[model samples]
Target: MSKSKSKRVSIPRSEAEMPSHVYSQLNTSFRSQDVEGDTNLPPVIRSKLQDLFAQIEKEFENLYNENLNLHDKIDALNEKLEKENYNPERQQTIFESTDDVIPVKTSKHKLSGSSQKLKTAHKLKAQTSKIVSSFKTPSVVCSVVKELRGHRDGVWDVAVARPGVPLVGTASADHTALIWIMESGKCALRYIGHSGSVNSIRFHPTRDLVLTASGDQTAHVWQAAITPDYNKTGASSDEDIEGGGEGESGCDTDIEGGGGTSTLRTPIAELTGHAGVVSHADWMSGGDLIITASWDRTAGLYDVEKKELVNTLTGHDQEITHVCGHHSQRLIVTSSQDTTFRLWDFREPIHSVSVFQGHTDTVTSAIFTKREEKVISGSDDRTVKVWDLRNMRSPQATIRSDSAINKLAVSNLGIIAIPHDNRQVRLFDLTGQRIARHRQGHQRMVCSVAWADEHSFSSNFFSCGFDRLILGWSIQNIKDL
Candidate 1:
């Protein structure tokens, strides 16, 4: 072999780069003379190359599947972030914008049919213009104000004084009733005589007297000087009047030495009789009779002139929460934690004239409106309902609120004030249209709301769970009555 060494034929660099097995197979399939001259590769070598291509194809498929799975994971994370970003305090807007798309064509040769092309372009332009014009803008307007703080220990009740007077009364679990002045934005006075938490306070229709119901099982009358018109001199010049002949001598003498202007600060009387806590009390239209509801499941009528409890009305199976005398003085309405509202005839010593039983939760407050022919009630079921006195079997209208409604007051201008647990004071017209919403900064829950006049309103809204702060709001507007 050394004598005539057969030099190994060198393969081209491109074929030499393959595996030695592939090169060996290629070499075995063809003669050296034929491989040098032939343009096509051997069948065996081609088969090996095909197997390598299939392996690469499978690897690419696996990589593509992994990329798709990563994409799905990213999409899931993005959706979760979007939901977290949504804020309930912000107003939601639902509107879309439409912008027409136009296509442009560029060619070396111009169109031979100019009329057809021009007509098509004009049609497209018209369609785009129409779409742009039809696009709508958001038309809804939302109030920028939000709820402030609410009470913590639970707001028992609220009342507003007469117009132009910046005073509001709030009863609370703190065992006191606070008088707030809007002008000074400070608590003007605290009526602190009740041994327990005060449940309610109501301003007299004409006088500066305020009546408060307390858990101490008693009601107190507070006299605050609203104006100088109140008699302070205590001088009786009409001693021999018509109805006041000889018996008036004692009455005149009693009124003569009552005091000067300080008499207005003295409580007119303290009415007591309820076996349980007095939840609510109110003065009648004439300011002569006071109606009070108690947790003993009974409501009582007090004769202010006689300074004695007149009648005891008992029917409710649970605690009585509220009571109101009719504007005509012929009837009375009451609400209870037993989920019922009853209409009573004060003159007839019989049964209730009608019974309202639609509320699914405890009725906490009730008021007679429309000259005492209709009644409005607020309940823990988060609803405010209006009912006709004639048909108390069902409610005529039910307005749903965001939270439990504790108090309802119908303003003289036909606006209804609803104080809710969301620390909001809402104003609704008789038709259930929300006209205004005020954010109260109470830290706990808003217990009550009342209107002093058409142009003024006050809330005895406070929170004990917060900082034991009481707040009052006064709003002014130029809208027609």
Candidate 2:
């Protein structure tokens, strides 16, 4: 038998050990040099050149195999981590709350009726084009001014107190609510009466009281004070906090750190009657009554003084997601997962119900803009519809987004502050023109957003997310040309 030739095995060169000059030589133009197959080369030199090309091809194959091995190891590590942290039950609950998002682009409706009264469609197009053309750069610039932290779980809602007190209240899933000093980032007081998560909170329109809705099927009115007595007492006992028990009508919170004597630890009253979880509650423009939306598919009208549910407005076919009181009217609107929202006149309750049906999925939030003239509704379908109260037949305009919306706040200038599930906060003009897109600072889905003081030159807003952090954002107005 003929002697077998010894097999040659090539080893991969480490990236650092690879010859640097070889890369430069390979990158050189082949047209300027004699190729390996050229007949002008001597036979010995030609044979050597072929060997050099073979070596380069072997090195390339080695590098490619090494890269693929690294990728396979990384993928295995990621899969292991995912398996270690998986929770199917919690995943199902979240899916039920916001509905699974297929991640699409869609939203609609007009700000009001007049924007739709365009004599010609071309005029509307021209106006939109002018707005777009004028914005050569981002008109609004916002960044996280502060990151407030304290709660053990995600913050669901945040509300700013009147200017003088300089207080910010936040509700959380940690079975507690915190009142933080806006300037110092210190937790002043804590509320812990609810047996379940505190879902929403709103500061009293004219007093130092906060109304908090919870998953425990109850809403509690408590003192929201910023005095020295309650300062840094976030560790106060739960019994000491809810000392007044259920319904004992206390006093207003003295936010100025003055000598006013009022009990700040106990809850004032607990509004009870919801069969399911009370998602949210809001104070009417007049501040005498409070309206609540519950998972029971109805909204409750409560008298603030009596601390009792007076009427239950019913029409939706699914759980009510959010409720909002008209800015200056006795009307209230409730959004639900039934894909429709109903406008209710508290004066007549059941008799004066108007159903606005258009959203194809759950209506996440609905709010009145322009002094109850226009209603803006955000849905899980990734669309926000603007309905003119004057013409309820169709939408005034429509705004589309990439993610499902949670709760949205609108500035006095008709700009919508929309918080999304994709960890983005977007601002849109009433005409559906995107004003700004803020995508930083939150590690999880952004839950709720609130406007600071609208009268200031630089409009400021706050956003909270499932990352258990509250971020304060400010947008400096683009100076006029």
Candidate 3:
């Protein structure tokens, strides 16, 4: 037992850094005592000392191994830094803030229905991947293409039309949604129905509809005045489709259009059932169904045409902070303040198909990758974890961040955009290797970001934040310099 206890004690690596003479003296003294074991020492005490020395030797071995591992980590980090061309000045930026600082709002409520009983089996599978010993920070170039400023308050979410239509929608704390023409940066339409802050926004996968989730505990679906073919042809201007001439400056504080026949603000449907704030909402690829997560600790499945709630997903112990549904599969994933994310087969929204717990703090955002086989999440703990839907036991990989990751966006190319509280946006590959970072992109916390299309290598994306500005970023490949 004494020997086992001694073995459990680890040697301090600091001792190895001491002068060589000190270590030699200690070793020689111990050896000399062993030679004189025949004299003066009590037998029991001698046995205990021998056990202690054996334990020390074992601990030394462990210390040596640990030192090697640490050195490897250091070398990997150095290589990554060099590859990214890392500079302290580039990672940080000067800020100029006004009164538009947007404070984070948190809310909570109980699940609406506990009247029914449900049963589900818990199962887990194992997964494997290449061990990424360190973060792979890649080099990138970012250029600001447009700066849209129309919202009176901070902007919380931005969603660009998929592929063809060069249109962007922004949700703001000003209690309105603005649809902008990307090329001209003109606000095409301003939706003014939400009674509270618009927390999230999304464009329909195959239609001219835009969905906005608000702190008013409702989700509004608005019809955009663009032709279906324009949504598939990557049109540059709305003048040909809408027959509206140039209206205002791209950075003008004034919106472009007035109440006219061309502009529409009335929503097709207003789905309201949550008892608390609705933080996130998304449309399936079919554009027929909508999914939402709310502070009521429940996820609701709604029929877009019927404009009514079809089912309620309840099981989370805390507020459902964010939700994303698969574009191709019948699955949906949600993040919660309970520091856990749950994956549910939307066909059966009554019970969670799987529960993923790894985040140490509130899980602020989660999204399904293009393949619908994996889910990635960001948390207040300043880390992003990726999980395989098949293997629900442990995360496949964990990407560390310098600050809390407030939002995460994944493109079809397997690239991930992480908006952080430190006023920076970072992009990474599916393998957890950081490929690029945009430091000068925002003057305040980057509240949200979204890709313009499904192109794997598309250079253009949109971002908006507490700075009350909508930004378009175009990525460029760097020439050898």
Q: Across residues 1-481, which tens digit of lDDT does each residue of candidate 3 receive?
A: 3321111122233442221111110111244354565567877877787789889967875764465455346545655544354332332221112112323442322221211111111110011112121333346677787788788776878888876667788988777787877666656666766877788889998777799998888999877755433221112234323323344222233553322213333567999899988888999758899999888899999999899999888899998888898888788888898989988885654444688889888888888888558888998778998888788788887887656687688876677889876567888777776677786767656788887644333337888877788888876543221
**Residue-wise C-alpha lDDT for candidate 1, range 1-481, written one tens digit per residue:** 2321112222122211121111110101222343446548787876666567678757754653454344335435643443344322221121111122222453434433444565665665554342322222212222322122222233466676766555566776656565545443433344556666677888777776789887778888866543333222121123211221233222222222212112112245889898887878888767889989888899988988687998898789898878887655667788888888888775655644567787887787788774446788888777888777667677776676645676678866556678665445676655555555554355334566665553233332222212244554444441342
Error of 3 at 334 (Å): 1.1
TM-score of each: 0.57, 0.66, 0.66
- How displaced is residue 391 in candidate 3, in Å? 1.4
Question: For candidate 2, lDDT tens digit of each residue in 1-481?
Answer: 1121212222332452221111111111232134643468787987787788778867865764464354335545644543344333543354344422322443334323323443334454454453333233458778777777767777888887755667778888776777766665555666777766788888877777788888788888887655654432322234454323222233213222212212344577889998988888898886788999888888898998998888888889998888998867888899888888998875653458888888888888899895448989998777888888889898887886546777888766777888876567888877677677785777656788887754342326788877788887767773321
How many backbone collisions does model 1 have?
16
Q: Evaluate residue 17 in candidate 3 and report its C-alpha lDDT on the 0 to 100 scale.
A: 26
Worst 10 residues of 2 by lDDT: 19-28
**After best superposition, candidate 2 residue 326: deviation in angstroms?**
1.4
Minimum summed lDDT over a 10-residue window in model 1 is located at: 19-28
